[model samples]
Target: MPRRGKVVLVQVAIVLSLLLVWESGVRAGLIDPFFFPAPSTLVARIGEWMSTADFWTDVGVTLLETILSFVAGIAIGTTLGIWLGLNPFAAEVVQPFIKMFNAIPRILLGPIFVIWFGLGLTSKVALGVTLVLFVAFFNTFQGVREVNPVVLANARLLRASKWSLLRHVYLPSATTWILSSLRVSVGMAVMGAVVAEYLGSSAGLGHLIAQAEGVLDAAGVFAGIIVLSAFVVALDAVVDRAEKRLLVWRPAPAHEV
Candidate 1:
């Protein structure tokens, strides 16, 4: 088997071993089930959720919010990042404003968004966009600015048009940074959407978790968290696939024979 496949298998084995230990420890009363629910209990709760139509609805709502916010944030960030990266004057002019917004706690804006957009998908998506935007923006900006000066000079010497230079030079260079940052950006998008739901929302995993916490059901909370983690892992897998496809021109790392 490939080294990557072996690594994945080992990781799965480790998780399974830990889960077994957790379940055994809880059942044997070595650990408090109240504070740390057994893996079996959490799994059962997850199963119960899977059987409910409402659970699917909540999943859909959260997924929609995450996707919308992630897409919008990436679009806006890439555009502005590229523009500012190429124009030193514009970057300098907007630096302080960017820093100011970035420094503010995104969670604090959740209530404000709820007030502005109400307890709906729009508010959640808006909050997520805010969370994801700067991460993508900064990565793209840095990537573009860091492009090789010699390569650029050579491109210009070759009489490359502005559009051609951007397509063949600038975008390719920034793609690496943008793609790497998108993994974090996607997680932030999910966090933002879920947090907005926690504040005020009719549906979503965050709302479910909030409800669980309100009732002091540790199993329910753990189940909800596990479900949310699954979503994030799945989304991250998608991002990984996208990165591989889009960055096919990039050289693969050397592997031992």
Candidate 2:
């Protein structure tokens, strides 16, 4: 097999072995399943959810909120980040306000959102957007400010106008920071959606988990978590692809830890 294929097979084997051991340990009564669910049980519960309409609706609501919130965050954050990054004076003036908002716990803001937007989808989406916006904004802002002066000078030597400098120099320089923020924002978006649901909502995975918790259905809680994790992984993969496409000009060798 090719190297990548061989590595994938090894990973599959490792995962399967771990699952078997965990399930065996639980079934043999050597391990408790209450706090930690076996992979088999989680899988079975997920399968049951797949067979239900309510499950799909919950998933849809969560996905809708996550997508809308993430898109809004990106639009607002990117624009603000670029603006602040290009203008040091603006950055300095706005620094305290930004810091104050960032310092406040997002969970505290969730309640106000609930009161303002009620138990509707708007509240959940707003919370998610708030959570993701700051992350992207800060990163984009730094990316802009950190553009190399030598590059700007070279662009100036070529008689590049402000528009040309922004397009060619600032944007490319900040692409790294924006992409880094995107990776993190993907998870934050999901978290915001779920937390909003937990506070008060009639549907969605968070509400589902809350209901299951009330009934002491440990397996169901694990099932909801597994679903959310899968959603996060999938969205992160999408962001990774977009980053690769948008920043194709940047050589990969420079990004090593």
The lDDT of model 2 is 0.89
Instruction: Give the number of the best model, judged by lDDT.
Output: 1
lDDT of 2 by residue, 1-257 (tens): 88788989999999889989999999998889997778888999999999999999999999999999998988888899999887889989999999999898997788899999999899999999889999889888888888888988999999999999989888888878888778889888899999999889999999999988999989999899889889888988999899888988776786543
What lDDT tens digits, residue by residue, belong to model 1 across residues 9-123? Answer: 9999999999999999999999999999999888889998999999999999999999999999999999889999999999999999999999999899999999999998999
TM-score of model 1 vs. true structure = 0.94
Model 1 stretches astray by more than 4 angstroms: 1-9, 255-257
Model 2, C-alpha of 233: deviation from truth (Å)? 1.1
* Runs in model 2 lying further than 4 Å from the true structure: 1-6, 254-257
Query: Backbone clashes in each candidate structure, one number apiece?
Result: 0, 0
